[model samples]
Target: MASLFAFLRVISLLKAVWTAYSAFYLFRNYLAARKIGLPIRIIPISHTNPFWMLVDRHFISFIRQLPFGHNSFTRYNYRGWELADRYFSHHELGDAFIVVTPGRNWLYIANPDTIVEVFRRRTDFPRCLELTEILNVFGPNMSTVDGLQWKKQRKMTATCFNEQNNEIVWSETLGLANDMINYWSSKALLKTVAHDTRTLSLHVLSKAGFGKSFKFEGHDERKESSPSTSYKDSLQTILENCVLIMALGTKFLENPWLPQGLRRLNEACNAFQKYMTDLYEEEKQAFAEGRTSGRNLMSSLVRASQDEAKTGVGLTENEIYGNMFVFNFAGHDTTAHTFTFALYFLAANPQAQDWIYEELCQVLGDRQPDEWNYGVEFPRLKRCLSIMLETVRLYTPVPVAKWTDTRTQSLNVGAKTVVLPPDTMVIPSYASVQTDPKYWGSETLTWSPSRWIKTSNSTTANLEDEELITPQHGTFIGWSEGSRDCPGRKFSQVEFVGTMAVLFRDWKVDPVTQSGETIETARERVLRLIKSDSAPVLLLQMLHPERAPLVWKRR
Candidate 1:
């Protein structure tokens, strides 16, 4: 009884100490934030704190139930807060503000000019490697490095995403989309639109990224390729359980006492690592033998690294594996989520489907899917490309984070130039600026692809030319901006356009209306689903996409 009482006393004392320390730390950060000369908001816990992230929504829910708990600080003290808050916070606190917390001060900027300056001065504002360290779970790759190491990886990555690779992405995406459409058409009402699109995306990545190809399998049709594991199964499992893998890490999940699902994820991690190793070995052998027929991303990357290795400036074997995983991770989920969003938006707005179909007809004419050329027809499908752009405008998957590491940086925000302290995180307000009415017009929130199209009279007035409208530098950072923009920007665009062309050219998707529900009501439901049911797991995506099944019909 004495020992129990002593233990309880220790716990209470420790809790008190922690509370006091947190208060002091937050106060210090607040003082620093004030000196930055920006509007400041305070939150008790940092959004990046892993333990807090795990319980953020639940804790906030409990807090809101208490008196004086429902406030901006509680609301915004979570990861992916930008998705919910949007321009409202920026409106309240001007174009720039600091969110001060015990962990760090986050400087959120919505000003386009300031954002452009930050992006251009990469050294002044470098990537927040601490936040992105999870991406190095496999090994140090392009996404998780900086300085000279980043330069080397960037060069090699650039080579892999060349025109030849984009062509592969285009062809492979078309084939996968065609197969997926056939599978979708067979169903009366498809609840697995998100799942199917992810499958299509994974297959495309497999073909283009690693020279591996898999047939598109519907939700019901899928079977494990092997009793133990298959490449597709491993990759799919890893991607699906990304948050779990990232949060708990592979080492912890691999423990034998873990739950069955997590153990399976551990198996997947091992299987994927093995698959990458085997591919790396094959590519190395191919290079040694001078048999350079492979043109996939993995092949290109391996060849480039080999040539550079002779000069002591190439990616190591683990680095190659790491990059392959990162590319697959980046290319797969980002496009798949965008595809799901675009599909739902199209289903809700049938006119948008027709808009893309019109462009497809204009570009492809009498040519079959096989005859469509990437270099020629892809550029002509402006409406299709616009759909991708507009979808991302509304729902950016990966909002990037930059920081001033160990250096005081000066940034011009509106009329004032402010000095930021070292270790300050500078996040571009993607959600706010992308949808700001000042730049995107009054209907900024509406998912209208036509907004991106501008028609002009040519020299002969009879002929009209249409082109995509270029938004202000920082307004539409769908693929980001400046020096360190997404290297696979064109790769994703090619895949999206190819899928849109194939899917909409001959078919249109409509929300599967519930019993006694009007088509208008069904469309509204889908729109609501898109707005409310979306959040970031690893990236922002529709959470319960299956709740709103869709039907594809021949137009």
Candidate 2:
């Protein structure tokens, strides 16, 4: 009885000590932040905690709904930047503001010049390697590695995204878009546009990355519930179940006693590995015989690996597979989500569609999609490019995440010198900066695709020829900025442009109207639905795109 009472006393004493220590720790950080003269918001929990993240996220959201709280507090997720704009719309956060949470400090930057400085000084402000560790599930790939390993991976993969690969993307995308358009046209009312776009992206990535092709169809369209282990089935399964793979890992799923879903995942991963291994062997044999064409990304990576093998700097088998998976993951979903957003934007605004169709008519003339060469035809379709650029600007698929140097770093925020602590996360809010009126005029919040294009003659009905405006440095970072920017920028551009030309050239799309809603009202409702319903999934996408069915008609 005495020992039990003593143990209870110890537990109570420990809890009291912990509470005091936590309070003192937070108070110390508060004083430190005050000394630096920066705006500070102290939260009790770490943003990374799943439960606390959910709670605080909802707390901020709740605050945002209360009176002017909507204009005061930033929400905690991807759309957090919406309220971030309200907070820093006038540069109230100046170059950066400090967000102090338990055991972590986040410095969110809204200033373009400071963002450029952060990007330029890579050594001073390197990538948050810890944040990307999830991407290293298979092995150390380009997205997750840093320093020498990342350099080697990047050099090997860089050659794969050249002009030749882009040409392949352009041609393949045209074919896929044509097939997808046919599929959509067959639908009584086109729902599942998001799923359809994802299918199209996966097909394009397959052909462009691995030189594999497939007919466009719904994800669940296979007649057999359990298809044989083929490249299409295996790759699709892997892509769709990435979160599961990330959580449970390849090893965990190997257990014989696991659930059917996990067993399926294991089978899919094994099948994908087999497919990749065969591809690697084929490429190796071709390289040995000096017959390598380097047509697709995989072939290019394989060629690079062979060349590096002589110098003892080649990617290992695991590294190669990791990179290939990363490429598929990074390339597939992001571009697909971008496509969905751009499509919705175009459908909502018929004027934008008209502009795109006009440019397509002028650029392609009477030439069919097959005849439309990447080199000749792609350069002429600037409006299509503008639509993509505009969409990406507003709905950036991936936000930039960097951290302060190991040593304290000084930043010039307006006229003040702010010293950021070592290892503090530095997020350049792309949504806030890209939409800021200082760089993008007063109508920055509006989805006006024309903002990206400059007309030669404002009054001329011939809007066929217009120059795409290049935003000032650091102001436009949809594909990100500096050395670590996305390598597949051109790949995505080629695919997006090709898909747009193919789909919108001969047809018009509008939201399906309900009982008494006119086309214009439906369009307005769609615009609202996208604004309200769109949130980040794997990427920023229409949360429930099926809620708004689109109708297609020949123009």
Candidate 3:
């Protein structure tokens, strides 16, 4: 029996290796065969700096014809942020058009109408592809759950984030903001080191999303505010590693012989799974006994998964955890990145930041913490909100969004017919739409909040029959377009607004370093790279020079 089992393992191992190589070769062939339309134009990007150089240029050629079609590339200003843009955008075949990922099972698309249709069908457009590891590693959590399951999970997950629930959540956001802003005001260090906004925001999400209080929020004896060991850092590392191992899954799964790294990763997944299971059980028990209102997000999910009200389809505890992890990555990283990038632009344009601060004080005027929630406080808040929204529009958190259509349906895109069968990779040109001269106006590239306020200077374009999707345009599809977009949108927006209000109400910021650096990172759901080691940091308390540099005094 033992010998037979060993022999079976050997066969499995060889098959996995073969499949991996076959997948790689298939992708290479696709790349070779692909070509761009001649009249459109193509820029040959050197394989070496192709990604970063393009991102450094923000991908929208400032000078269209010169550096574009010539085997060269354009990128974002931040070098680290460019990699994702490269994987997501391509114009002419090899130039800046589509990327034929490995397995040949997916295609990276940037066409405007093609992406719109992909988003239109929530059932068909799944966030995951066969090559994506987020779904496999995390399981059917809210983030990866699709079809009816996603819809159900999204509903259960949303109860905690609605405007009605804002009061409940404000307790946490306001508290954290106070700590963060005040601490910055008191810091002695003129310089500080922290991960880009992605990581910093993760800390905020932990407190807001899962309902944990921040360890580094207020007047601290603590100096460094980064995630400390076992729980925070380890979890982030495991998630990032999940992305890595998934990329190498074919080789690792082959040979039935478990590699040490794979084995270790598996163990971590199991442990993480177990942790989630325990929490679910606890929440379920509390709700059952009527000891808790099931107010936080986890409790809501547990209740729904166990609800007799939910017939036919329901979620498992493990699945909810998987979703929570996705929520963590999406909510945490996207929000944080937006905050960081917004700060970068705001700092670069201090006049806008100052305007925003002045607006806040005008409406807020010695008001108590909860006063901003009422109807009277809206106008000033709206202006501040518009600035943040505009910042995201200018430098979106994610450059590319990729999905696969699982339905045997067709959608019309201009003159072309798109047949989306199961696993058809679809990509959206997010950076283009946000920065399009036609829709947002030629001055769209300029980082100005006044444009979003709908002034005479506010311009509109005829991209589609409907008004271009702006903040005023109902929902910002940057979270995604259509029903299939991120369910966590409302949740993330609230977290962002709450945190920003708290911090900015107390400080002023400007770019003193890493101002022109480009963002670079490996292509995936979330970004992890910073443009440079000297990347810009939001200076604290400009009001009192002697206090903390991270926090400035209110003028």
Best by lDDT: 1
The per-model lDDT (C-alpha) reads 0.88, 0.81, 0.50
Please report how far candidate 1 places residue 202 from its true position, in Å.
0.5
Q: Give me the candidate number with maximum TM-score.
A: 1
Per-residue lDDT for 271-357 in model 1, tens only?
999988888899999999989757899899999998888988789888998888899889989999999999999999988887777
Error of 1 at 383 (Å): 0.4
Q: Summarize candidate 2's per-residue lDDT along 25-115 as a digit string, tens digits.
A: 6677666677668777675555565554445545766777767774323444323444335325336556567766555677877778888
TM-score, every prediction? 0.95, 0.91, 0.67
The true-versus-predicted C-alpha distance at residue 351 of model 2, in Å, is 0.9
lDDT of 3: 0.50
Model 2 CA lDDT for position 399: 79
The parts of candidate 3 lying over 4 Å away from their true place are 1-114, 123-125, 135-138, 188-204, 217-275, 308-310, 368-380, 399-410, 415-424, 455-476, 513-553
